[model samples]
Target chain A: MDIFSFVNFFLLPGVVQGSIYALGAIGITLIYAIMRYGHFAHGDLATFGAFTALFVAGLLGLSPYAALPVAVVVAALLAIAIDWLFYAHLRRMPKIITTIASFGVALMLRSVVQIIWGVDTTSYTRGISRPENWFGIRVKPHELVTLLVVIGLVIALHLFLTRNKWGKAMRAMSDNPDLALLSGIDNNKVIAMTWVIAGGLCAASGFFLGLNTELRSLMGWNILLPTFAAAILGGVGRIEGAIVGGLVVGVTEELSVLVIPSEYKMLSSFAILLVVLLLRPTGLFRGKIL
Target chain B: MDWLSFTIYPVYLMIFMCIYGCLAIGLNIQWGYAGLFNAGLAGFFAVGAYTSAILTTSEAAGRLGGFDLPFPFGLAGAMIVSGLIAWPVGKICLRFRSDYLAIVTIGVAEAIRLVAKTEDWLTNSARGITGVPRPLGDLPYAQAQLAYLAIVGLILIVVYLLIERQAHAPWGRMMRAIRDNERAAVAMGKNVPVRRLEAFMLGSALMGLAGGLYVHLARTITPDAIDPMLVTFLVWIMVILGGSGNNRGVLLGAVIVWIIWSASEIVTDQLPAEFALKAKYGRMFLIGLLLQIVLRFRPEGLLPEKLRRAPLSEGALSPTGHGARIQAPHKEI
Candidate 1:
């Protein structure tokens, strides 16, 4: 393929989609690091956040972008509530129970979305969005916005983790919970803060996905496996790794249609996941093994 | 409902209960005894279902099947095929903790579903494979249903007896020992990874048996018919609520949860057209809530696993710790 065709059709769209996946993977990585288990419901949490933005945008007659802040806050609170109500009691239990409980939460969250919005595909606004051409490449306004927001969020997160007290505490807890606790870090507060950051990012990812494509009830569930593959492939607990992993997975999947049938696009992410597991279980960045 | 119709409904429900009972029993072996979290219950079930369907179904023009095997042979093939699928997955994943297994299993199930969707020559794609003859197909409708129920019930009984025997066997004790404390079990010369793989494969084989029975009962196999999340989660809830380690409790759980699931659908379907769809989702919401509640309050489930005490030889109890490990029941659940 020529450079223009590759850049416009495959590369640009891949990066746009990659940004969304990166946003979701960031949350998955955070939860995996801080909570010490795979939060299966993270995908649905994104769906909920996106729909929450959609709902508010409808109520206020505002653009979806305008409603982003409210959606982020609401989603973060919902995350905290879910943790307190469902996962807190299972703290002493095995990691598997919490993981299973997260699956239940996924079901509940998706059903709630279905019940509220019905099953039809909906979007932020009703109209075709044409991409503006820049020299040889074309990009949609919303896609550009998604990419910008993701970059901004990642930079902010990097600063927070490196400079902020609570962020450092999160890293410490992730490294060694017992030792972190012994060192006077408030475990509960760190956990709550982890959910806040993860939940907000999850909302942004879901919102961006809705912006880039249309929103459907099953969208989150469908993308969930790939998002997880990105997280694991990047190395579970590493922030920078999630971004690189997401981009690689997204770009590779988009490019894979050249070799394989389009219907089997999803299988690539899984193939990458298995290959990574077999070759290097610690992932590219050497994050947590589990 | 009339007497015959009412009678048939219960029989239908009972047949499903038996099928799911087989599933729960299998899960109990894996999660309950071995502490392996297998989230892909439907994948194994599908392998069994498709394997049996291919083996027993009549000739079709474009598809791969028409082996025209006997029902017993089909069922056995189902178990073996599912076990084979599990073998490599267990080999790779058993080395890690349960969390990794859960993720890999989910991926495997999704991949299997995708394969079934895309592989037209194998599964006939969306058209699916039809004309798979049910056992005793010549009998009257009610009679056929009852006969199939009997067959499934018989299978359930045989599986129950076998698994129950194994649970109380020396091997079963060793499994629980390994699950309760892997390090201690290893110190006592237990090959933890291999034994765990065996448990995973065996449990998957039973799940396959359930799938074979299911396809035979339905008389058709389609990708959509097996709703992965619904079936897998239902089986998980059944085993968890009934008591993971206890075989009898697992069976009771299967019946109770299946009844609730089906009954809710019947009730929800009665709602007006506008509300009916929402009510359907409401049922799902309730089921999910049910899992959280069950996990919170009744973590051991309705029927907790019973502890057993078996005598050990003098040399066998060398570590003195071996006796404590033996007597220390599997309390992790």
Candidate 2:
């Protein structure tokens, strides 16, 4: 392939992959902003959402596209339930408590999946290969589907965040929980809503990711680092930053095949993360802080 | 392979848990007492295991051209390797906020595991190093295991007592100050970085020691054998459940958790095939549920790290233990 084709090929996958990663990273950044401490369980949460979508689609005999909307709904509900179960009472606890609790929640979720589905990895859609031919690239139908969904979600999210009352409320709470609460934001209601939005986005990201590749109960946990790196690199607590950082990391990792072995794909992400963390503590584009 | 045979193994495993208890207690000193998280405990453990594997079982001088060094020297080398790694990680990672630091440490852990897994030059590829003989393996089987257990148990006891004593000493006080409030300690002229580094190195070295003990029992080592989730998370649970800073509670925590872990693996094999899967997950679910509930109900932990108090007459505990009150006010970074 010529340089144009190679770069385009690279950018296409990078952008598509980055968008899903960005979606997941946004949830992490938002959680970090309000909850404090890393949410180790997030990758699994995405996996759970995707697995839920896979199950619902199989049960209802719906196509991948049709199953996606229902999956989003289920994921939102699940997020709300998880938050209520684990994070609701944790508001009063110290920071580390929530971090540890998230780990617990993560482990429990993965174990439930393992017990129910068996350790063997499963996928949302089966057999017939996703045909290549989108934008002169060898991208598949599922890849295109993932890309379109991500772009739509990102745009919708940006508008909701900028123009909506609840968006401002969410931003305020992230900025300063105490100030937001004092300014008449219902901490409980806002937090529940945060979970809903994050949950929806997480489901969409998970489904799209599953579309691109096969889904395993553990896939989400595996890719969590790049997602977090993107979020942190983009500047924690900023949705745009997550999007940008995700693309950067995805591209860097995929492109690293030039020098490093393919099996060491994760190392590139780790390298980006370590370099980002060491050089820029608050991220390259740190957003407004309290 | 008779599944029932594993039942006889728990008593021996319980003794192993005691070794883990010692490591967790050391971790509690760093994370619980000093608020410095080391997610790379598995890496340190692997380092120790590989150290001994290369030393004790060198019939095949493969990669790194095996020295076949004595076991004692191998253990020392493991401690030194861990301490050396800890110093640099502690320096770079310690500067970030706790959240950032934790994530980075996790990344570092995976990196270390990956290196061992992929680089045959270091750990002899995925085939792993084998034929490791325990210390006194030439003795009778039961007697040798018991001897190994006894010798390791003694080391754990000494390490435990030392940690307990040091936790009350002046240096321990400085660590607590940094944990509770970094700026205040810095203002009081505590070499904050050095002190944190010291705590990290000590904790990591102990973790390496636990790894060494583990290899001696199993008599073989594989890079893939290290489970970051099972090994590191269990340690985190142990320290958190025991109360981050309390040595006594950590031992209890390890014993309780590991007993449950081993018992689950042993007992599940006897179950009817239908219920086997659930039995396997039952253990994982319990740990996760326990961690969440404990954090919610007792945020300080099962036994919160209680500060060693002085007379209230002297105002809040301060530098110089005598009447010197020094609270360094902060200038934000």
Candidate 3:
């Protein structure tokens, strides 16, 4: 294939896909850092968020982009509510119990989505838009929008984490929960804040994925393994690491079709995950081992 | 319903119950005794099912079968192959915490499912492998089912007795010690990793056995049969609800949960077609909710593990010791 075709078909799509995985991985890494458990419901929660955005867009007769904020807010609240109802009491027990509970929550969320939307694939728009040629490469409008939004979200999150007091509190909690508690950081407030940020980002990721591809009940679940691969690759608790990890996983998956059967594209991410776990359990950014 | 038909359904349910009983007990060994969170139970189960199907089936043009082996050999091959797969997985993942094991195992299971779906030469791809022989399968429907049930029941009983013996043995006590306190077990000179690997492989072998039993009963094998929800999560709930560490408790859990699961389908079928389709997901929602309620209210399950207590010296009863005894095992994962 020509370089232009490679750039358009492989590189651009990989970057876009990577950006989406980065969004999801950020949420996962943050949850792992703060709560210290793998949030199995995360992918399904993203599915719920994407569907929520679709619902809002249809109900309000607005553009999907305009409905994004509503979805983010709703998903954030849903995250907090789930934490309260299902996970709050389990806080004192073993973290594995919470993980198992989250698996149940995953099933619940997916079922709820299926009950509401049925199983057919749906899209925000009816017709496809051709990618505009820029220099020697081609990029679609939505793909550009996805990249820009991801950059904006990451920069804003960086500022929030570095500058804001509550954000510092979250960092403190993640760094050392007992110490943070001793320092008079309201543990519950920091946790709720983490959920808000994680949930909102999860929605944005899901929305972008749905915008680029078609939305289905299984879409989030399908991407979950790759998103996780990205999170662990970047290191479990590192934001910047997650971004780089996402991009790497995404580009590799897109490129792997050249060598392996397209049917086995997902295996690329799984391989990356296993390799990373074997070589560097702490991830690329030296995140916590746990 | 005719008496024969009525009798057959219950027998069929019982047979399935036995299969699930095998799975639950296997999971109990890993999760209850060793505290290893194996989210890829379906992978092992699928491996066993596919191995047995391939071994026993007659010649097929495209796939790797034609062994035409007997039922016993198929079952044995299933267990051996499944255990072999678990070896590397346990070796790598057992060093990590329970959550990491959970995610990694989930990945492995998904990978296995993908392979089963895509590899045509091995699994016959989406069409799946069919025409596998069943023991006494040539008999009339009811008689065949009863015979299969008797065979499975005998197997289940044998498995139960063997595992019960192991559970009461010193091996079981060491496993509990490691689960309850890893450092203590290590300090006491126990080979934690090796012991864990043993439990993992043994449990996986039984899961393979369950898969073999399922394939023989269905007389076919399909990738869809390895559903994460049906094979993996259902068994998880069974083990948890039945009381993880206790073998009999998990069997009870299997019987109860399987009845509810199968019966719920009948109830849902009574609804309008559109509503019936949705009710399937609704039932899943209820099952998920049931888990949360159980975890919240009775994390110890209906039948809690009974710890063996040492006899107290005469007039040497200590209230603090008694209180510690009550609180000790409750901390288990």
lDDT against the true structure, per candidate, is: 0.88, 0.76, 0.89
Better by TM-score, candidate 2 or 1: 1
Interface RMSD of each: 4.4, 5.6, 3.5
What shift in Å separates residue A134 of candidate 1 from its native position after superposition?
1.1
Indicate which candidate wins on TM-score.
3
Writing each residue's lDDT as its tens digit, candidate 3 over B83-105 gives 99999888887878877778778
Instruction: List each candidate's DockQ score.
Output: 0.54, 0.43, 0.55
Candidate 3 error regions (>4 Å) = B309-333
* Residue-level lDDT tens digits of model 1 in B1-333: 445655788899999999999999998899989988898889999989999999998788888987999999999999999999999999888877787788788888988888888898899988888887888978978888889999999999999999999989989989998987788999999999899999999999999999999999999988899988888899988988888889999898998999999998898888899998899888888989999998988888898877643466564555533322221123232
Q: Tally clashing residue pairs in candidate 2.
A: 0
Global CA lDDT computed for model 2: 0.76
- Tell me the deviation in Å of residue A242 in model 1: 1.4
Task: Please tell me what DockQ candidate 2 reaches.
Answer: 0.43
Over all chains combined, what TM-score does candidate 3 have?
Answer: 0.96
What is the lDDT ranking, best to worst?
Answer: 3, 1, 2
TM-score of chain A of 3: 0.99
